[model samples]
Target: MYPIIRMVKQMILHRNDPPLSAMGTHVSHHRCWPWDIDLWMELNNGRTLTLLDLGRIPLAHRIGLISVMRQKRWSMTMAGVSVRYRRRIRTFEKFEMRSRAVYWDDRFIYLEQTMWKQDGECANHALYRSAITDRDGIVPPAQVIEAMGADNTRLQAPEWVQGWIDAEAKRPWPPMQD
Candidate 1:
């Protein structure tokens, strides 16, 4: 089940929080609920990714990108992601999620996020490739940045993110195609 209501709650909670730069971090708190766990009594792997949405969307809101998207009738979607899980989150345990935009290329935006336990341990971390879209099709990263009014401040994409882009470029569209 999608946690729409929980997402709404998170939106309202962080609505008044301070804004941040494109590369700055936005943090949100969440608990490992029973529904978020698996048969082994740990947070489900898939649930971890879904809950990260709660953090990323608010980060967008704080950076004012959400408003820009709404004004332009644009939308955003996750194209791909790579994540690392280093620890287990038990049901009822509390964790803080942190998200931020890391870089962007001509077509995709890259974001990095992490879930941290109260003791400052990272439970998981992920790098995401996302695309902005409109009714016509995916919006180019340059256009999205222009809409955000950050067009003049160009930043180089990080090396690791560039590496991921390079690897994806060499992958065939229909991987099964001979």
Candidate 2:
């Protein structure tokens, strides 16, 4: 089951917190409950992505993206992701999650997120490509940025993120020989 209840709690708790810059980091904490573990006694890979939603949504709220999306009746969706799991996270272990938007191109926004154990070990990290959409279809990221009332100034996406974007572009959709 998804931790939607916990995610809502987080939203209410941080509702009044100060906002961050478009490229600023948002740090949030979470724990690995027994239910979060897989049969191998570690955090399930799917659960990790769901938990990442807690960090990314808060980051979006802090950066004013959520507000703009709401005001414009737009929605956000994850278009793609590439993740790496380095260390196992055991039950009841607390971890700090860090999320930030690194950059945006005309069509998509790129974000980087991580889970760091209390002992300072990085358990996992992921790069996400998100799209803002409306009834018409996918809204250009440039339009989303402009709507947020922030300058459209962009920094270079890290080499790795750019590489992933390139690789994803080469993949065929509705895959399988037709």
Number of colliding residue pairs in each model: 0, 0
For residues 2-99, could you state the per-residue lDDT of candidate 1 as single tens digits?
89999999999988988776667998899999999999999999999999999999999988899999999999999999999999999999999999
TM-score of each candidate structure, all chains considered together: 0.94, 0.96
Best TM-score goes to which candidate? 2
Which residue ranges in model 2 land beyond 4 Å of their true spot? none
After superposition, candidate 1 runs with Cα above 4 Å error: none
| Residue 104 C-alpha lDDT in model 1 | 83
Best by lDDT: 2
Query: For residues 86-136, could you state the per-residue lDDT of candidate 2 as single tens digits?
Result: 999999999999999888888899989999999999999999999999999
Candidate 2 residue pairs that clash: none
